[model samples]
Target chain A: MKRFSLNQATTRHWPLPDLVAGCAEAGVTGAGLWREDVQAYGVERAAALIRDAGMTVTSLCRGGFFQQSGWEEENRRAIDEAATLGAPALVLVSGGLPAGSRDIDAARAHVGEAIGRLVPYALDAGVQLAVEPLHPMFASDRCVVASLRQALDLAAPYPAETVGVVVDTYHLWWDDGVWDQIARAGRERRIACFQVADWVTPLPAGVLLGRGLPGTGCVELRRFREAVDAAGYTGPIEVEVFAEEVWARPGADVLREALAGYRSHVAELPAPVEEDDRAP
Target chain B: MKRFSLNQATTRHWPLPDLVAGCAEAGVTGAGLWREDVQAYGVERAAALIRDAGMTVTSLCRGGFFQQSGWEEENRRAIDEAATLGAPALVLVSGGLPAGSRDIDAARAHVGEAIGRLVPYALDAGVQLAVEPLHPMFASDRCVVASLRQALDLAAPYPAETVGVVVDTYHLWWDDGVWDQIARAGRERRIACFQVADWVTPLPAGVLLGRGLPGTGCVELRRFREAVDAAGYTGPIEVEVFAEEVWARPGADVLREALAGYRSHVAELPAPVEEDDRAP
Candidate 1:
């Protein structure tokens, strides 16, 4: 419970004030928010609401879309927004290939350069730019970074504090190589955010908003949690599910289920080894 | 045009007889087949039909489903059918996790052992078992083998003639490591089959039927064709798309479009280096 955070996306339609009050009442100490939701409620007001409720902002939903025009100004604004909201990380969903373009290698190189250009602004704002690798299904239209290795490589040239990677299970569980990449991210101190969601089948049209709540699908959620822990990540675990069915339900109901799933699947961290066990 | 083969799934609604006649009329000398369709039309009868039309069966659609209860018997039948139809290769779509199973590592290891078990049957039948690594999107429910590297690793222990891999553009296009893996496959002589399909977005529900014709989506079709060719795969280049929209159209119309797309995107193989030019 101490490490559990309900990402606002899990209850996307929940009013900002209600979400803050609900999180406080439910004893949740952290909340991951979206830029649109914050801007709609006024970023300062949203920040004040969370602060008054004595909850911390775990992360801001997004900052990247480097393929679009004016991405520089847009991302700078996002960094400012993250700083104003006291969020430590801004997630970046690197946009897909430019229109009518099939040059993926070039697009990936552009993402790396885009992040490099944003590093100074991110540093100044004290917000880590968390490069998220979306699922490969989105490689053509949503994101060019489809593996944790690519995200880490893109962040390698910048300081760990200024540029890092987001470990989101929904987009990464299908990858067999992710476990090693998670360990590498931790070794480099580049795992800035860890988000949890399950991989569900019969994905909806467009393949977005098809994520399952923690235990509703086939992902080895607890195994992923343990892997990240073993990799030295002790950060807040945000439950960031996006599904139409889940959103249609009451926010409180969804939050409660997310908490229950976390408790069942992610709460039992492995016990620490005794000093004697490590002795030769 | 001589290298083009139409996989039946691309024109799924066409009757087996009509498809055979259509291919013969269109000067398509090669065809890839599905087990169910062949069985429905009587494997012997279908083989006779193709043989009578002076057409060759390039490969069989599938054999592996190692997680199922009767996979050994099922795959044995598939091998026999492929041999009867004169297909040198039997493509295998390794099944996903058994119902409710979470141990993907164990599932993958089981696939290796299962293939080892079937190697004798495959070799005796004179059919190469071609392991296909499907897109990662199908990792959980369709196929656990999700990358060309993994497919090659699984095939490494077996004789190249008895065990090989399928290089499908739709499946391998997003992988950055595929070019090197293709070269490795060529060096190892494990490239049993080469397939082409484009990757259209806004993927329909279930995602199994969202593949596009060669030039209809963002895949670098020409690059994939050249990569496989460089890997020493000089076999039939089968266009194996699976889209509801394509299926809804007339088979002849779809075939013409497939041929046109192949010509525009995949037909221009790199010119062979001349002996005189190489003799500096």
Candidate 2:
């Protein structure tokens, strides 16, 4: 429960002020926020509101889309906003290929180079650039970084504190190689943020908003949590579903369900057996 | 043109006879058949129609859905139909997770065992069981074999002549490791069939029918054809695409467009630089 955090996206329709107050009232000490919401409410005001409510900003939703024109200026602004909000990590959804381009290998190389270019700004802002590997379905038009190995590799050239990877279960649960990659990220000290969401089927058109609340779909959430923990991560587990159905519910109601789902599915880390309990 | 094969699904609305006549008129010597269409038209009749037109069955559209009940009998019948149609390869789209189950690893293991069980039947029928790895987006409900590597691993335990893998560009283009895997498949002599389709986005709901014609989307179709050829696959390149818009068009019109797309994007495989033409 102490580690539970409500990502703003889980209750997207909730006002930032209401969301902050709701999290405080519900005993949630952490909240992952999105840049649009914070900027809409004024970054300074949103920061002060969360700070006043005795809650911490776990992360800032995004800062990458390297394929677009003017990405440099746009990402620099994002880094500034993260610093202003005192968010330690800025999630980077490396955008997909340039329009009409079929050169994915070149696109991936550009993402790595783009992140390298941003490392200095990210370090200066005291914010970690968290490279998120979107699901492979989005490889053509969303994010070219479609696997943890690719994300980790993209971040490898930078200082671990300046560039890291986001471990979001929704985007990664289908991969058989993720467990090993999570371990490697841990060994390299590159896991900046951990998010929880379930993989639901009959994915909606565009497939972006089809994520389910933990325990509501097919992902082995506990196994993922256990794997992240085994990989030496003790960060906040942000519940970050993006389903339209979830957002239509009352924010408070969604928060309660999110907490309940977290308790039932993610909070039950296996207890370490004492040496005395082992067979002789 | 000799290597061009129009998979029946590309012009799904076309009647079996019309599709055969259309392929014959277009100078295509190969046609990939779907089991449902073949069964509906009467397998023997469909075979005779294709054979009488001097066209060969490049491969059968499918034969695997191991997660469902009675899969053994169903797959056996599929193999027998492929044999009757003279399809040397029977492509397998292994079904997804059993209902309400989260054990993807188990589902994948079940696919391997199921293939092993069918190997004897496939060998006896002189048909290679080609495991078709669907894109990972279909990992939950459509197919559990979501990458060429997994399909190859499953095929590794059987004779290459009896077990092989399908190299479909639409399902595999996003994979950074696919080129190497195609080489490995060739080295193992397990390349049974090669399929070409472009990946278009703003994917429609259900996602099964969103594939684009070869030049209509972002996949490097020529690169994939080259990779498979370098991997030693000298087989028909089936232009297999599933799209609602495509199916709604006139069958002959679609076939002509498919042929044009194939010629522009896939059939331009590099010609052999003759020994006599090489610089002395």
Candidate 3:
């Protein structure tokens, strides 16, 4: 339960103050936040409120989109905000191919270089730059970094403390190579942030906000949690789902549901009885 | 032009009689057929129409879906249809996780064993089993096989002549590891089918009918063609798009556009000055 964190994305409409208050009442000590929500609330004020409520900002939502113009400044601001919030990591969603362009290799190379450029700034700010590999579906429009291996490889050139990779189950569960990569991410000391979200089908139009809460879909949430645990990751496991239905619910109810899902699907420590549920 | 094969999925509404006549008139010697269309037209009759038109049935649409009930018998029928159509390969889109199941590893393992079971039958029919790895977005609901590497790995245990992989640009384009895997596929003699489809953004609802004709989106079609060619596969380069806009157009007009897209975006011999369109 100590490791359970509710990423604000799971309840997107929850006001920051109310969310912090609700979480504190629920005994949830950690949160992962999105920049849009924080900015609207004033970063410094949000930081103070979170601090006052005794909640830890596990990681900042995003700071990538390197393919866009002015990305460096935008990310630098995000890093500063994360530092202010006392978050350890700033998750990056490296943007996809520039509009009307098709060179994915170049886009990926730029993401690596962009992260390298931010390493010194991140290190100075005491914020880790977490390179998040989005699902391959988002490779064309949202993020070009589409696999954990690619994320790890991008982070390899920089110091582990300054540049790390994110292991988000929703983006990675489909890859058979993810287990090996998660182990590799651990070996390299690059597991900066871990997010849990299930893969649901009939992806909505645009496929942007179709994620399911943990235990609601096909992802092996416990398997991912176990893999990260085996890889020596003892950090907060954030339930960072992005579904419209989740966002539409009362934040407290959604949080309760998320916690239950997390407990039943993710917090089980032992791995022996896993096959029992899968004997089809 | 000689190596160009139009997968019927591109202009899905084009009736078989008109499509074969259209291709023959355009000097297109090959086509990749879909099962639904063939069954509708009568398999033997469609086969005769293709043969009479002097067009080759480059491959069949699909025969996997190992997660479904009666997959073995269904796939056997698909193999027979491919054989009767004189197509040398039967493409398999391995189905996603069984309903209410989250054991992806088991689902993938099942795919391997299922393919192994079909190996003897496939070899007997003299038709290659081409395992097509769908994009990861479809991992939960459409196909569990989500990468070229996984597809090749699944195909590795069987004879390459009987089991090989499909490398479609739309599926493998986002993968940075695809180049190396393409080379590996060639060395391992596993490049069974090479499909071309650009990845358009704002994927349509359900994400199934969102592919673009060559040059219509962000995939490096010529690059994949060159990589596969370097890897020792001189097989037909099939343009296999599935877009609503494409289907709504007149078949001949769409075919002309597809041929032009293939010529400019995919069949280029030299790879110099490749970054012209990306000079952002």
Candidate 4:
């Protein structure tokens, strides 16, 4: 049976403790948490609450914003938080193009430099830095890692295990190179996590929060599952929606809906049948 | 000096005659026109008016809806219109993913097949087909040719003189693969037209109408010009904004702004430094 995890950010209206308690009641296997919540609750207390409720922490919310004043210090702090929280992956939203800079290549190079400085600390802390390539709409004000190929290239300079990428369908579905990039990432052993969400209509300015829950939009979820599975990634398929409407709903209701949507759309995906299995 | 061409869609609010008059007043050397306007003006009259005003028709607005219900007949008619207008290139907005279909690959194949069938007709009519890959945001409703690479691939099986691509900065700017794809298209002799517009903020559901006029947004226009020039594309850099607000402005104002922006941006670009120029 496939297990499910709900990113706590989806229930952002609720506090960490309440969100975790709701997840526990809903019988979710795990939760991906944001560092802001962890800091608010204190990392030690947050981890304790998760353990007390018997929930696995699949991932820490994020660490990368490596294009600002004091990015080195910020990244170090993020890695420290990831370590303290006992999370396997520290998701990195690579900072967007620096203000007033029209040079995307320069911004990308800045990201590479920042990540290079942070990789060793993250690896030492047993935290994998998962670079999340944002959609191109965010190319100016958000992450410069806009494609898996670009993310993989940035990760190439680091050890694959320590530096990886977050495969979020929302940011990447429009890209033609996605499948090829996924294949290349898999071949190079660079996939850190597989995140799923649907791309919905009426995209507004603040493009980050417009994602739909699974089964609510046009993505071919089954096909996406098949491609990732084919690429040798059998990790937790985390549900990470940022819908304002969904977040506005009660955390418990959101969790219930996410689970139901996940089960209906993802868990039922047909497994690839091998010839040997058929014979058996 | 590089010449400036006004893509009439930049002043979509204006009728054909008024747009031509505006462009001529603004000292634009050429105009990129759409089929609907041509139909409205009556094809022969539109061509005659453009000739009378002494404006070059750089490329016809569009021809491809090859993924929809009326693909064949529509494409044939588009060829006729392109021929009637004596358009240097008949821009093809390869239609989007069809209604009730998740098969983008099938739609793409259909586009390839449609182009294959239409190429000979286009050649016979002396109208070059320029495949225009719209921004990926329109992948579901407007165009499946979402990247220059994909457009180049679609054009590969056809002769460049018969079928090629339109490299519009608005569509191709977000693509990290763009520079390389443009270079390759140049090598293959497949760049049919070069268009310009800027990517901007605050994308609404009607974002199709929110495009920025040249030099009004974050795109590195001079850099784009350098790349186009480096690819041996010395054709007029056609300004093709689709902003509703810009269109709502008087047609004369739109043309004046577009030309001024184009001149300032293009003046900084290095002239052609390469030999392998794309065809058609």
Instruction: List, residue by residue over A123-148, the lDDT tens digit for candidate 3.
Output: 99999999999999999888998989
Q: DockQ each candidate and list the results.
A: 0.75, 0.78, 0.76, 0.38
The local lDDT score (0 to 100) that residue A269 gets in candidate 3 is 52
Local accuracy of candidate 2 as per-residue lDDT tens digits, A1-280: 8889999999999998899888988999999999998888999999899888888888998888999999999999999988988888999999998998999999999998889889888888899999999999999998999999999999988899999999999989888889999999999999999999998888889888999998998888999999999999999999999999999999999999999899988897558999999969
**Second chain TM-score, each model:** 0.96, 0.96, 0.95, 0.93
Of the true interface contacts, the fraction found in model 4 is 0.30
Model 4 per-residue lDDT tens digits across residues B1-280: 3368888888888888888777766666688888888898899999999999988888897888887778788888888988888887889998877775667778888889989998888889988899999987777678878889889999999888899899888877767788998889889888899899987776645457768888777787887788877888878778898877887898888887887787776546446765656442
Estimate the overall C-alpha local distance difference test score of candidate 4.
Answer: 0.82
Q: Which residue ranges in model 4 land beyond 4 Å of their true spot?
A: A268-280, B268-280
Tens digit per residue, CA lDDT, model 3, B140-234: 88899998889989998888999999999999888888999999999999888899999988998899999888888988888899899999999
Least lDDT summed over 10 consecutive residues: which range in candidate 1 chain A? Answer: A262-271
Provide the lDDT at A162 for model 1: 95
| Ranking, DockQ, top scorer first | 2, 3, 1, 4
Summarize candidate 1's per-residue lDDT along B1-280 as a digit string, tens digits. 9899999999999998899888888999999999999999999999999999999999999998899999999999999999999999999999998998878899899999999999999999999999999999998888999999999999999999999999999998888989999999999999998999998988999899999998989999998888888878899999999998899999988999999999999988557999998996
